[model samples]
Target: MADKLKVALAIALVVAGVVGFYLLSEQALVLRVLSVLAGVAAAAAVASQSESGRRFVGFARESVTETKKVVWPSRKETVQTTGMVFAFVVVMAIFLWLTDKSLEWVMYDLILGWK
Candidate 1:
């Protein structure tokens, strides 16, 4: 009975949230704040209860811990990479322009005799 009531209350909160959001969609600020409050209340109720909630909490904690272990590149490394990319693009652009000019010259002056 007690578990049923908790589940019902959580479901009610979420349903109320959805209805409220639909009604308040024209007022973005109020809708967002109310939606967040509703979500937090629902989460709190869920966390207060059975085995699934505990597992969810543990998973969330591990995710945060794993996120903290990431290593990021330095600014110097980023700048060097950016410079190399730009140099490659410039070289490719020049090569393409030269190839196009050579093709144009051969088609017009050599074959069609355009001078």
Candidate 2:
């Protein structure tokens, strides 16, 4: 029940921030943006107190840790893979164009005698 209330309060905070932005439309762009940011920051702080929020924070932290552990492809491997993909795309494009032109020739010139 308390967690639900906290979530609701967080949502309210976000909505209030949005309203504040609109209300401050005549103000400077930076100030309007700051209003929204402040609201969002307040909401985040409030939501972080909830159980589900805590779990989400933990999950986010774990995701960051896992990402750090990943062995990313080297620059050379990346370049080679990109080059192969580009080569394949160019070959496929030429093949498709040839097939299309052949079909058009057969349909118009040979079969229908329209060309």
The most accurate candidate by TM-score is 2
Backbone clash total, candidate 1: 0
TM-score of each: 0.53, 0.90
| Model 1 per-residue lDDT at 106 | 99
Per-model lDDT: 0.80, 0.98
- Which residue runs of candidate 2 sit more than 4 Å off their true CA positions? none
Q: Model 2 Cα displacement at 76 (Å)?
A: 1.7
lDDT tens digits, residue span 1-30, model 2:
999999999999999999999999999999
Residue 80 lDDT (model 2): 100
* Global CA lDDT computed for model 1: 0.80
